[model samples]
Target chain A: MIDEWYPVGLFSQLDPAGRQTALMGEPITVGRDAEGNTRVTGGNGRTLPVRLRYGHVWSSLGEPKKELFAIPEADQPGRRFVDVGVVRVRCSPLRAVENFLDVAHFPFVHTDILGAEPHTEVQNYKVEIREDVDEVWATQVKFYQPQAAKSASGGITTEYMYRVPAPTCSVLYKTCPPRPSEWDVITLFVQPLAEDLCDVWPWMALFDDTTSLTDLIHFQQTIFLQDRSILENQIPCLLPLDPGMEIPTRADLTSVAYRRWLKRHNYTYGAQLVAQ
Target chain B: MHSDTTGSWTPVALSADLPAGTVMPVQIPAGSLALWRTDSGHTAASADRCPHRGMRLSHGFVRGEALSCIYHGWSYAQAGNCLRIPAHPGLVPPETIRVVTHMVEEADGVIWVALGRPEGRPPGLEGLVPLRSLTALANIDAIAAAAGGKTSPQGIVEVASGTGTICLLLSRQDEDRTLIHVLLKGITDQAARIAAVRSTESLRRKAEDIHKKEFAQ
Candidate 1:
């Protein structure tokens, strides 16, 4: 059940300091030894596999069947890779990733900053499960962004494309204000601390070089913090695949497809199969 | 008129702790409750879970006199009646859309919630005032052992401390923890208040240590 690699903490956060954290509700410590290698110890000094990627330290309770998902844009030169840090959300890990995939809450939760009233319309988007890579993708998602990016001065219609390579991870490619041709990549890596709780680590690789590091971190943190209250207060806490507990509109197609993919993979770690 | 099912009273929290237009989670003998106070200084206690999708009403917010769920902004009155459904503003919610509520009584800086009919009112701290409430990672027995006194039938355990007498009103929380509300018998000065706080903190530490040692065996 713990065969998949889940991120425990940021590599930077662990390299400089030892952290007491949990992975799938198992208390574990994340730190580096004297030889400069990642060390993870669970209850009663049980060690697990440790790896560093995408500015995060990942560990698996059991042998992972696959390596960490790839983010090619992270290594691309001239792109500012900003680590937005972690936020503990009292909701399922899959729910955190699905919320990142959702653009419908922009006007309601992120009002005025990302979207505003009267502009709260979600047009049709294409969603599918890619057979070759066994991933979920949603494309051609166009939304009116009051501030498209940190570098944007005015409103613009932003285009978004979402990719879900892992059950708890999702990547978003959105329209960049500075470079019209290139798309900014924002990725959410959720660590399921328990079936009803998770820690979300959001990383961004964008084309803009103007915004300072603190501003970039703060801008993303504000948006995520605004969402944290809503996530924790949701019913059942775990992500419900059956949609019986909730009413889905036309805009929830991506979420529906993602749930289907998760069910197909039998990723029931943080998923509620029934309505309750 | 309240029935026999709404009579047994248990001290849930302090009146000062729950401010106006705020909701807090509380646990009693019956179960968990959403203890809240309206803007007009009226208090209420409702079943912790919401009726819609079972969201914890304690995690919800209060606007004016109504408690609104944080998930979808479903508002409910202090009398356990549904007032507003933000998603469907035009439609009037049916009478069955109501939450189970308990009878609440606030007296002498303490708030008591009732699940069923009781013979008498909650114990009145006539001269004592509530200083603070702290959770101890120990059971009631461990806390009583640490205080060198037995808990009375009224849930009051008096400990003779160097800073005079400190009375702790214990409430069971979860499995191995106790919510202790510290009440000062006579001391109410600034220095005495600080001393009472220190005494309770020391008691909690000792109780937790005792509990850990006992469980480790």
Candidate 2:
């Protein structure tokens, strides 16, 4: 967890006035200099590697072996890029990512907005590790959403594709209403503050011209805030890698695959080895 | 510190803060507590963690007389017994599936939580009435020094300001923080009440500064 770059705060959250934030349980200060360049100081009063990418301030406490993962849709023009800001979640970062990948919760946690009763069936989906690139992907995921997008007027069968490029970053591709040919890219970047606490940063690149930016932001915030209560109230705030405590059915294939990938990387930063 | 199992009543909160059909988390010398009030306006305190999966019962919602966990909808009665488990509606919950409970007493608009079996009721507030409650980032000694008074065994410290006599009821939240409930001794007007509030704020600032200095030395 230390070697990898984590999103500390949004680019807009930082200013010349300066602010203090925490990453990986270490307190850090971020500010701008006279020339308007970003300056960061770690908990030990030492310089840290700071990078501005995808509208967030990324920092690494230890030496990072690789750069931040690239989202090709972010560079495409005419796509509305939104910064949903940071939301503090009282659960493990891995649990947040895992919850984002599971569509079965739509009928329950996100009722009426994402899914409603009578259409709560989760069809078969394909989950693969993609060993060539060392990333996990869940494809052919289809779910019915009463309001799929901010611009959507009616219910539609929303097709989703989830990609887990890193331990705490998850990108979702969903069917766009305005641009039916293309898909909307929504990403969740989690900064694990502690083993059982995290700050989630959600960014989206969508193809919608009718919806206002404020409405889009509110829509995403409303959806995520509904999940926050469930996330925090979950027993054992840390995500348990073992399925012994929980009963996973066929609908939890994606969650199962994600757990396997996390286990493969030995990403126990916010993972509980056993159910406590 | 009042660490005795009995005769130790901690003023956890004000009666106005916790209304009917609501629950909140509280910390005491014994451990954490899930303080809740039923729809009938009866207050109860239970061990915070759920017996099912260790979920904080403070996060649960109150429905009528039972508190239901948000995770799996496991409801517990006011007596800390598991009333119902949503997953198995037909099966009766075992007797062991119950949380530890504590004695609660509400008087003079202040909510008192007992650590163990108390021999008698909570200490009387006499004619004093609770005004407001606030948390200070200082221990009992620092707070008493700032208020120019000594704390009694009952955790009541009387502070005299220019406006009136304000009594500070202290409850140790942790090592550094103390929960203080402000009470008025006599009938006061609006202006006097405002002054009491301001004086309490000043006392908190002074006590925090003294605490910082003590730590530094």
Candidate 3:
């Protein structure tokens, strides 16, 4: 988990003095060098690799074998890149990613904004662990969402595809209300400050031209903040990898696959291995 | 601090503070627990975690005689047994899917939670009436010093006010925090009650100051 690149701060929102943050429980400072290039320094005064992608400053505590995962929509023209900022949640980073992958919570947590009563049934979805990229992906997921996006005028049955490129990162591709041909991309890049704490950086690449930038950020922030209360209040704080610890229904296929993938890779930083 | 297996009863809250059909989070030496009252006024304490998911049951709502989780709507009875699963309506949850429940008793306007099987009921404050409950960011020692009295074995600290003696039931929430339940000894009027409340507030402030100073030293 320490070897994976984690987002520290938004490139546009970094403080001049230095932005103080943590990665995998190690205190780090995110600042720019004299050349205006992003620099990350660990608590031990060791310089770490820094990558500026997805409008955020990414860093790693250890040597990473692979480069930061790519999001093709971020590079697409005419797509508005929305930086939704960071929300510090007192929960396991794995749990945050799992919650982001879950569609069943939309009706209960996000309420009318994402889903409403009687439309709570989560239809069967396909989940797979792609060996080619060593990533967990869920496709053909459908849910009834009210005001699917900031530009949505009414309710729509949203089509969603979720991808977990990294243990703590998840990118979501959902149906774009205005441009049905193209998908709206929303990504949750979680910085695991500790085993049970994280700083969630939610970024979006959308084809919406109607909503203002502030309105777009607010809309995303409102949705994420509604999830914060649920995330923080979850008991045990750590994500339980043991199947017996948490009972999952058919709607939790993505979560189950994610946990199994994490277990397969032996990534148990913020995960409870056995039932307590 | 009390052990979970001991026959010790910890004062969690005042009876008047926890109304029927409401749930609240309470902390004991062992850990945090969800204390909820059924619509029929039956109080129960269970491990805050839901068996299905780790969602805190305290965030759930009380419908009829069951406590329902806000996340997935899995309901639990007062005995901590899984009553229903909203997602799987027809299926009856297995008995193994149950939250750990603790023994609770309400007596003398105070709600007491037993860490284990208690040999006796909670101590009775015969003539005193509960005024209110407050949390002080100070240990029991600091509170005792501020009140100019020490706590009895029953966890009662008697401090004389203008009207009569006010008894404070102190429960150590953690190393630096204490829960104080104020009780009035005599038949006090509204003004005296207000004065007692003010005095308790002042005592808490003093205790917190002392605690801060002690930590600095």
Question: In DockQ terms, which candidate is top?
Answer: 3
Model 2 collision count: 0
Best by TM-score: 3
lDDT of 2 at B155: 86
How many angstroms is residue A5 displaced in model 3 relative to the true structure, after the best TM-score fit?
2.0
What is the C-alpha lDDT profile of model 2 across B87-172, one tens digit per residue?
Answer: 34455777767777888999889888887676677877878878898988898889998989999878889987554679999998
Worst 10 residues of 1 chain B by lDDT: B1-10
lDDT of each: 0.83, 0.83, 0.89
Question: Model 1 clash pairs?
Answer: B5-B116, B6-B116, B7-B116, B7-B117, B7-B118, B8-B116
lDDT of 1 by residue, A8-46 (tens): 888877763678888888898899888888899886798
TM-score of chain B of each: 0.91, 0.92, 0.95
**If ranked by DockQ, best first, what sequence of candidates would result?**
3, 1, 2
Docking class of 3: medium
Model 1, residue B52: what's the lDDT?
A: 61
Flag the better candidate by TM-score, 2 or 3.
3
User: How large an RMSD does model 3 have?
Assistant: 2.7
Task: Give lDDT tens digits, candidate 1, residues B1-217.
Answer: 1124436667789888999999999987556799999999899999886776456789888989998775445679989888966534455777778888988888899998876766567767788789888888898889999999999877889987555679899888766878898888867688878988988889999999988888433
Model 2, residue B149: what's the lDDT?
Answer: 94
Predicted model with the maximum lDDT: 3
